[model samples]
Target: MTLSVQLRHGGPPLDFAADFPDGRITALVGPSGSGKTSILRAIAGLLPVRQAHVALGTEIWAEGNIHRPTRERSIGFVSQHYGLFPHLTVQANVETALIHLPIGERRKRALHCLALAHVEGLERRYPDELSGGQKQRVALARAIARQPQVLLLDEPFSAVDRSTRKRLYIELLRLHEQLAATVLLVTHDLDEAAQLASHLLLLRHGRIVQSGATSEVLTRPTSEEAARLLDIPNIFTARVDGTASGRNLRLRWGPHALRATGPLPAGIEGDLRWAILPSNVLLVRPDKPWGSHLENPLLVIVEEVIEMGTEAVVRLQPQGLSEARLQMRLPVRAVHRYGIAVGREVTVSLRAGDIVPLHTGPAR
Candidate 1:
């Protein structure tokens, strides 16, 4: 069953509608105070809104003058803090979710859930006795003990260490595969969203800026604002010079002319914002002189190179530009092999298909 929601409020204003597909993970991501958590709370009936409509398939959870209580929503919620009862043992915490079940069955069901969450041995411990990761696992067990139809995770891994978070991600994916529960995950981490969610919703100031398949939204933001929010650093304003061929268009970026694939807005005139993903910008190898065959190859000076463990972020300034810079991400090995350093001249290729035009004109 798909989870559908429409919400509106005045203060801290939220006005957006979204549908979370069944058996798929849809991540709601944005900077802090973007209404990501508010949307989740509204859907789970934990927050009151002026106007809202929330439904799981044909079952309406909230609508005009009607709202169901949180308990009746059949959702498993894992808040950022894990929210485990301080006084309750791990097994008891999970068993609370099974209160509606037969008294004889609650213990067995709770134990089963604990085992499913990989915390069976720690069931006798209280929240204070458990590590952050262990507490998170217990919270997960408790959340799923009742076998909820929809899972609501609000930055569930944010409190854990990086290695623990990665392990939990795998566990969550595995559990989702087995249960096929519809999940709406709220997180600010873009990498986490990309790794876990198939669908993505980019929220900002209580509004949805974009929504689509994760790859599509991440690689091809529809607006300059969206691209900026996604932290894409290679946006440029370019003029539409003319058509290059049947499938390509010529764009003039300052002194440089670039070829880009189109479906550009019809009758589009003047300049528009365009962007390319850092990973899509290719560094030309000295051994292979195939830059001649590439669509957009430019000789640029390496302005800065930031080494980040196995990867490096290299900033390149095109030869004749005043302050414009293009950023590219490459493996650390490639950085050493190509001798990419500050103030060094280098050649980088920008594929026509990878250059995404943000809009035909100014974003509405």
Candidate 2:
């Protein structure tokens, strides 16, 4: 199924086309108001668009003048808030989706779905009586009771605790494999998207900035907006002082010089935006000399270290330069072994290959 959308409702229009492979999970990821949920709603026909087209293997659910209602579209939508009725038990909620069937068939279908969602034992419990994860399971089970061709999940795990959410991720993956329904998940959590989605769509301000395989999109963001939204912190605006047919240009950031690779327009000079992931920031051994001794190594003062489980986010202030504060994500084991702490001087390296040029500006 390929979902092509162009929508406008007195706001910035959304105009982007993407294909959701049949029976595969595709995540719509972006910051709030980026139209992630709107896109899902549009697909479900709950939110009509000025111009939209949805096709599932040659069957058009929606198109110009041929719009299908939400129920007719046959999409199972699980909202972020877990729209489970407080008064209804888990079994009743699942059975509600199958009301069109006979009473006996509804009970059978609900039980099947509950088992598939791994919440079979909680069938008699009300929404309030269940844990956050259990409530989500009931919601998912209810959504799938209809056996819809497409499943739309709008941040279904966002409300749960981290540990609970992790468990749900595995459960969802299991259910996805068992059900084999095409899924479109709306979420702002990139890690969640990367973990569960085989494909990714990057949305921004009602536009599809990029879409591709999960690994490819994360490793190679197409623009500054994409990189920034991905939470990549090592972005910089460097003046291009030299170039060789737009390959390996010499760039200057503050008083520091660095090398950049990739094709740019010939004679492309002046300031250009570049970014690198914090994980790529390497620490130079103290035994080695800094400066001209290494290609991109720079002496920096450790301003702060934020412990994050097994890894730490270390803020490095480059010495003898006016560059912005840089952050490096290093293993806690390495940090402790090297006795790295606040105010300690250390050498850090950013490989030229790691520094990616953005298709956007240098916002000087």
Candidate 3:
């Protein structure tokens, strides 16, 4: 099951074509001003995508001589600011989507959905009486109340704080299994994108940069733009020293030698750039016994530390690359046990499997 969409517009020109699969959450993500929202609106029939052809499974929603109005299409939309209507009670707002439900069944279904969304006690309250998380749940219940064929979420969890947002995401996953509806979720958050999406479509400048399974797209990007959008850190210029299959990449960061995983890009053996994530780098105490051999040894100074409940984020200033800083997220307990403190000197270790070589450019 798939929803195939092809779009074209006049001007400097805007065009894109995508096929969203059914029964799974597909995320459409991009940087600011990337036309992600416009594409969402087009699918909801709120905005027009001229010359656009849209088909859902066996149904033809839009094409030559076939245009279905928004009402005729069974779709549920949950926008960012949505909640129970301030005037209507939570139950009423949620059940409002049931325009054709039998009178007796409507309220019962609404209550069931509210309970499923974990807001059973909040049915009598209005939007103003609920917290941000509660309101988002209510919005969710409202959207799913009528059991629409498709669901559209536009940054629905962005309004809440980080912890609450994560909880809501967990709730969303639970609901996803219970409903198993075709979901098209839009968000600017990379972490949220990584967690909630089964398939990811990276959009940029009113176009699609890449689209594939979440793991594939996130781990292996197609271009420098896609890599940058994925936020892979510590990218640097490099060259292919030797090779066996996809290995033997020789790269350096401010005089520090490095290696990478996977095949080096074609024609980029000499003078190319590579990237690595900070989370992949391990830090050992400076006074610890030295290992027999290491590819690259970096003498880094601790710059800052941020405690976030179970996790801690550490920023560092490397010896060779004082201009380019590094950031790592680790467990709070690790820092406590190791007695890690700001201004301390430590040696960071890089594993061959951790480095992901990217296109040549200035990695920021």
Candidate 4:
């Protein structure tokens, strides 16, 4: 089924268009207060649509008299806090939505959901007694017990620790595939959006500024406004160098010169800013292939290296007077094995294929 939702209370408006394509996870990604939650409420009939319409398949929830109440809509929503009842047992919370069902069926369905959520043994546990991850799983169990036609998640892993959050993300993806659930998940996390969604929608100021295939939106976003919202680091200013209908730009960051694939707008050639990602940069021996889309190559000095468990973030201070600091994530092992320390020189290649030109600003 396809869902198109548009809503605005005051100030700016928010719009989202995408299909709940069968057996795929579609994510609604943006910064905080960007109308992600409002979209959820509007779709569930819990919020009023000011000047927009919401359509789910042939049913129009925000148009005409076709509105379906939250209880009537077959949607299972899981919020960031995992709103499980404090006084209720795990099984009770999971089975709460199934109140209309007979006792036997309700218990059966609840247990099945708990098993899928990997909370089977915690059936007798209370919300307060459960860990953050466990509570979220129970919240998911409750959602799936409703046998919802659509699943809506709102930053479900945000409250947990980094380790638990990663595990939960994997589990969520597995569950989505196992059930073939149509999902519309809301997150302020870029990594979550990149890893979880097949399609991405970047919202800002309550408007859906950009939406497309995850890579397309991330790399070649539609607007400067949308680029700022993606939190893309190291976006540089540059101009088109060659004649591909201005479909190329010569960007200069600090003393580093780079090339971009898209046509630079008029007056932006050599005088405008370009966008690059720290993570997109490759730090290695200068002899290694610089991938396919090669751009500016820099022999940078490792100014600082932060060992962040699984990954090490290396800060590179490029040559010359350009006051730009380039950062790249390398595995912990790579940092340790290379004896890559502060003041060590490394050749970092900022390839064109890795370039995502988003005007001249970082993604918010």
Judged by TM-score, which candidate is best? 1
Which candidate, 3 or 4, has the higher lDDT? Answer: 3
How far is 188's C-alpha from truth in model 4 (Å)? 1.9
TM-scores of the models, in the order given: 0.96, 0.89, 0.83, 0.82
Q: Write the per-residue lDDT of candidate 2 for residues 49-116, one digit (tens) a residue.
A: 77888777677788878987887876899999989989898999998888899999999999999999
Candidate number with greatest lDDT: 1
lDDT (Cα atoms) of all candidates against the true structure: 0.88, 0.84, 0.79, 0.76
lDDT of 1 by residue, 220-307 (tens): 8888888988999999888889875656778998788898884555555688788999999999898886836777988899989999
CA shift of 263, model 2, Å? 6.9
- Report RMSD for candidate 4: 3.9
Candidate 3: where is the Cα deviation over 4 Å? 10-14, 121-124, 219-222, 252-255, 285-295, 299-346, 360-364
Clashes of each: 0, 0, 1, 22
Task: In angstroms, give how far residue 321 of model 1 lies from its true place.
Answer: 1.3
Candidate 4 clashes: the total is: 22
Higher-TM-score candidate among 2 and 4? 2
Error of 4 at 3 (Å): 1.3
RMSD of 3: 3.7
Superposed Cα deviation of residue 303, candidate 3 (Å): 6.0
Q: Of the pair 1 and 4, which is ahead by TM-score?
A: 1
